[model samples]
Target: MNRGKLNGVAGTTGALCAVVLLGNVMAPDAHAQNSVTLYGVVDAGVTYTSNAGGSNQYALTSGNMGANRWGLRGSEDLGGGLSTIFTLESGFTIANGKFGQNGTFFGRQAFVGLSGSWGAVTLGRQYASSSQFVGPLASGSSWAAPGMGYGTHPADLDNLNSTNRINNSIKFASANYNGLTFGGLYSLGGVAGDFSRNQIYSLAIGYTQGPVKLALGYLNVRNPNYSFWGNKANDSTTASNITSPVIAGYASANTQQVIAAGTSYAIGSATLGAVYSNVRFSGLGATPVAGLSSTAAAYRGSATFNNGELNAKYQVSPALLVGAAFDYMKGNGAGQGGVIYRQFNLGADYFLSKATDFYAVAVFQNASGVDSRGVRAVAAITGATPSTSSSQTVVTAGIRHLF
Candidate 1:
């Protein structure tokens, strides 16, 4: 062949190779560029707990490892480094499909966001700041069953749990910078023309590099306890003033502010984590204990407190994992009412494959003060019939499959 023809062929071949490589990166999902995915999990099993206290407790249950759920999520790319993303997830009872959270669709999370270099802005129902900060440290990797982190903070102080989720909200998450990232959210009471009368504000900060992770966050919600925890904050009328009490030292009223920090370090087969959170709940941050008139008590209920926890997990083999966790919280005054809680859970999982697994989870708890104090696990939600109120010694073995 002539030298000119050889040179022309080589140039064309080089250009083709570069074009193909760049196309793979820029158009990797070209086939499904504007497609939605339908995914879900179905988990159900029988659960038994000791110390029923005259209550009939053993029974078959559902929504164990995976909250029998179905969700649709998608992303659309716009020119110039912009994209729109959304996730709509809902939970249902596998035993009956009665829908979790009292049959509300999208009870887990429902949000849409626009993402780019500046960060992402999301709107709709979601998770609260405290849950976003502490869940990973506590309930994130747990797969035993219920009785994990459903109100185990020294009288549910930090609300590290309660298996809580947020609603009627919008959030902004910042892009990563040198292992540091930040996020903030606000949930409007959704009252017409009356904003800030009953709203929630939350902020979270996190840092991650390699095997180390750290996070700290803050949340302020007016009438928050009833607003998020009791799910009553959404029903208040403008005419009805928030008459919750404020007690500094322990669990009491409806106003809540929580500041939490947590860190985790990974070393080979093990991961260690510890978290500390200062949760203060007061009625308008008021603390007037001496000679209060009856009129004041009629208008308020008050309490404040702090709680902390330490948790860890280990991977024993490719298909097996073992974990143990503990937490302790203390209150200052009558709110203590001996209201201290501690949980000890040891559990393991055996993977059948990438999508199927079996697990045996055991949890033990002690409530020292109130009759109902230690009945709930700090990292697991103990779900059962309302008739079974006695709380202690939860043992569950279940199978989970994902698709």
Candidate 2:
């Protein structure tokens, strides 16, 4: 009887093993279907400024060509042309190993969403629709290396270079339809008592066919001081993070609006592009907050800025490119008088490989008339300190690597 029992046990064990092996053979390999990627860019350079705070200066700069960043992107197939996707991107200063974007980790972007043939929907901190659709056509955000701001409008008031990001936002991007695409974004104010306070919304449409591309975008912000300029947690009604003399005095404006359009055409080895934008700060000095500074309170009524830009680039070879751009900005408002800015940019880039490049860029800006602060306008490069004089120049040489 003991011998019979032993044989029976052995047979049962063999059956179980065979079942396990069969299950393993029949099951799908989930790991093979899912994928994750790591990516990053590093940029460093030496810069010379003709004037900064009344003096010429030389320094080492980080992110001259492109911001330093690292990120993880992943996707998992859920079948039926649907996939779950996520991204976490962080920006840092290569010069000192410090976090960028107000010390927020994953500050540049952090989002998760679903995508398929229709398009994608994501939620998190995100760029405005203008940055997505119109920015690419602008040389400042495109081929102008060593400094994305080199060719942008003064202070990037139109956000065509994506100087600001929206927090607590939801975005939708449509799939390409015969080279046409569109998208929108809305940000929640998260204010307990006011639904519109600190709120922002934007929309954009783009078309690309053959060698021609065009895009248009619109952005509206309620309480731009708190919504667009300040951090997400910032709640001060009387204070702001805006330091640019270009628009600092308009920080208390009740609403900010931007409309922009851009187009580009490629001909042989040469490309030409043009952009126009209008920015408005309405209801300035409408609400007088307690402890408001005299500088901010002196403003009244509305402020408007109209900007125009033209750029050209040529591909000298497979690995070398040269570019030039010109920009003009005009500002007007009650009590603030008239302001005008003219800027010029030139750049050259040489690619050592697919993932590495060396670049040199130069920018010059001149300002005139009265500024938002009711004082003489001074040259203010978007990424550099405001000049004490009406004219300023910046030159940079940099190296950038991508992985």
Query: Best TM-score goes to which candidate?
Result: 2
Per-model lDDT: 0.60, 0.84
TM-score against native, each model: 0.76, 0.89
State how far residue 55 of model 2 sits from its true place (Å).
0.6
Give all candidate RMSDs, comma-separated.
11.7, 11.2
Clashes of each: 21, 2
| 227-250: candidate 2 lDDT, tens digit per residue | 788763334556666778888778
lDDT digits (tens) for residues 317-369 of candidate 1: 99998887786655433233445546666778888888888877776665444
Off by over 4 Å in 2: 1-33, 146-148, 232-238, 286-293
Among all windows of 10 consecutive residues in model 1, the one with the lowest summed lDDT is 242-251
